[model samples]
Target: MIVSRTALLETLSAVQDTVSQLIGDLNESEIKDIEDYLGRICRHLRCSRNALVSINKLPSEILGYIFQFIHADFASPSRSWIEVSYVCRHWRRVALSMPSLWSVVDLRQKGFDVHKLEAFVQRSKAAPLTVFYQNPPSDHLVLRALQDVVARNMYRVRHMHVKADVCPPFSDVILSEPAPSLCSLSLWHKGPAFPLLHANSARALFDGRAPLLRKMTISACALWYVYRITSLTHLALYNSEAHWFGDSFVDMLDGCQQLEMLFIVSPHLRLATEVEQQHSNRIVTLPRLHLFYIVRVVCKCYPLPWLRHLLAHLEIPEYCDFRVEFWMTDREVVPEGSILSIFPPPAQFHPLEQVATVKLLTTSTSKSCIAVHSKTLFIVAHGDAFPLGLPNDFLCPIARIVIVNNTETTSFLLWRTLLSTTTHLKTLDVFEKYLDTVEFIQLLCPDLGAEGVSPVRCPGLQTVNWACLSYPDVDLLFGLMAMANDRAHCGSPMRAISIWPSVNGEDKRTVEFDSLGAPMGYFTRESTDEDCPCLHVVEGLIAAATPKRPDEDGW
Candidate 1:
């Protein structure tokens, strides 16, 4: 898999050439590589030959059903489901017969020229067309073909995603005709595609005939006129252009009463906060909304006032998944308490317990997730720097917490503030990256006699199934032992401590506490690299509850 590209290509050429000619062109080292390549290819061919009969035994109907799963998103230029047509005569016939197979067209593939696209359209027949065109080149011929092959078929188009830089004429022609079957429309104006598509032009989209439109996504420009359709269930509005969301943003949500999911991404909320209190008498009620996600990038406005202003006008349900993220790649530090505005008040979505579960997620790209059930709301954060802490007013009753580590070096103060929020924390799970195991144990260790030391954080913290470790060292074991003993000295006891090998093998360190909150005996796992489970670790952590402690002690 790691062979050089040149060597691979040379070997391939040698296989295609005559043996006499291949030997003449190669040195001793090259000859050995050629033989190895030939042997591998021969094995591959033999395996394919042996399995060909059984695979071909499948009926055409089943084969077609299998082919349906292979869509345009899964295919690229070098390889594609279209390759099935060249396998044999029967396969080609089956592939050509299915109109639905050609419905989803990806116009980005270099091989799919105007003629091939036209052929696919003819095969698709009356099937509802789903077209994806991204980064269109500045070529007259290709643009003309796209306008003709796709823009002309507006009536039958169901889903259209166009991310390109086009003059007004092409953008206008895309939805010039009346579309009765249009359901989903996504337009991302990346490179100065006539910003906002002109207010007047967007208002007359689909010739005012699109009734079944339910989902619409507009980025780089906000098409505020889409509220004309009443059937919209999912709406996503992302505007990077400055001065876009004037004052009608809340008014726009108020118009569509059936929205189930709402996603918005902007540099900052451009709403007039004075409108925050002005709309107190008149609230926008989205009764069907389940998920509300908002992202702010290159933040220009303070998050607290703007977010609170937006939420004050909306009526959220009791049980909804709300996520607010700050993506300030500009490396500007956010204010200390601005994060508290991320959560809506209990009056908006009054939960039964009034408590929330929190999750903080950070990937290679400095993203943190915090989830809250009810009273104390937490969420997944998308921030450039994780400097701020979960302030007191942010949320309360944090019975659950999840911390997924990636590349960014998290601050000790931020982690301290996070764990200090709740005392009844049942579990603390972390995925290893930059944060060292020694550093984590240091956080749990009590700063008993230090000057002006804060109280112990998450004293009642329980089951911890550690996911990342550089290696099993004497320092790590000593730190774990210290964490157990120090926390016990603080009066609130800790629970089962599970340690994973430097690689990956479950190592449980169940520490039993006496009545007075002190560790009696605990389990520790010692292993060499060979003893550890041979697993390749990757990024991302799954949200899971810490396993319950068994009746017996360390095993």
Candidate 2:
């Protein structure tokens, strides 16, 4: 039974009168006893009233554990976890007492709340802090507040992310004292509103080398500023301006010897710089580098030699996965052949005994993406103004190619050029719009019309998996049959063909054909493995036939 309001008020009034009567006569020990009794009575009353609620009975430790699940990324800040404190006095105490919940302070909001910021910092006490602050494009009080807080808590910060329109001259606040606890730092600068500030120099983030620093992201800042921090293991740089000189970029790569992954998306390098010219001919080797990704946008003034010089000089390990994607709107389009040369031949540097898999994905009329995977190399590229067709001689001994065509605007001539290069192609997986094209049919059977004029493409072609929307024509069916028959006569037969047909309107149908197309299974909305299990069985057969490649052969 719940206590009535009148009873609760009377009980409080009586306790207050008793306390008032003893105030003058009671000694320190008597006063302490009364305070302890009141605390116990309040807790007991609260528990008894909430006894039937399951969550209310949870221990403080359990409540703290539940609060740990709430986390927010710095890009977007949400403090919904604070709602837990408003539920009841017990919850409020528990929420405020948990330091982990207040360890991450985000000050990216337009309106700075000093009370909230101070509360989080105070509750965190000695716990390590992860701070995220973004300075608005214009002047704001939040920027000053953030600067003060960061300066004061430099010793406590473990991870810091700052994005601002103008660079802050705060090397003293960050690097005056050694940051033993700081491990990760990300700083991004939006271009200054005043052009004069654009020429402002960037000071080194840390006065001395950050011994424990392992990861960093610097954007729109001087590229060479971070060369002093040699302990970095993961580094990402994004500068849309002409901030990178070839020498500075090379020096940075050489300096960060511990880096395992490096990502760079920037404007064209300043190749004409005297410093860059001095080191343009020198080669730099990275023994431990594993993954490198570069995306660049170029105009007529910035030629391919800058990128070519860098690629030609660097000596990476066989295990490194290197990828470069570029967009060029200049009238003088760099030949696809030159871009292909950026990636070395696997056979020379990192040879694989087993055949590799290459994927071609053309998403639009002007943009395309491709990925080449081998035992040692995994290269991928994407660009709006790059070549739409895959380079045939870029990588060797490809066993499989998967083409994903998303747009109907893809050129048939481009598809033909791409297919003509796969000499050892074994399995072809074509999706959607390209399945019913005459170009695809001709690729399979080069001897269809004129018997001896042209040789058949993909001589080692074993299987074809085509996902179709419209019904395949009789001509396409006959062309495939002829190719299979010709290969069989030559003592090498095409193994199988699998077709995935989508249901259109009320036309629910199953196809049954003879030696030409009958054996190929049809997949529908309700088809199970029992109905179309040949694809899996054939894949297993292929895998079983292929042997494991040796390490030394992985090029």
Residues 1-555, model 2: lDDT tens digits: 899989999999998998888878999998899889989988888778876588878999998888777645344556667678887877889989988777888876645477768888899888888988776565456666666777777777889887775444443355445566889988776763221232223544454545778898877765353435577889887763443435656666776778888777764354335224434555567777787777664433323455545565566665676665555555236435434544434443343333376666655432222222234223222222344344344556778767656555533545555567777788887766544344556667745534443644577777887766754554455466567667766656676765554423232222222343233333222322445454443333233333345653322
TM-score per prediction, in order, is: 0.56, 0.61
- Point out where model 2 deviates above 4 Å: 1-76, 83-98, 113-119, 138-141, 166-168, 175-177, 192-205, 223-226, 240-245, 255-260, 265-292, 295-303, 313-357, 375-410, 419-435, 440-555
RMSD of each: 16.2, 11.9
What TM-score would you give candidate 1 relative to the actual structure? 0.56
For all candidates in order, the CA lDDT equals 0.61, 0.60
Score candidate 2 by lDDT: 0.60
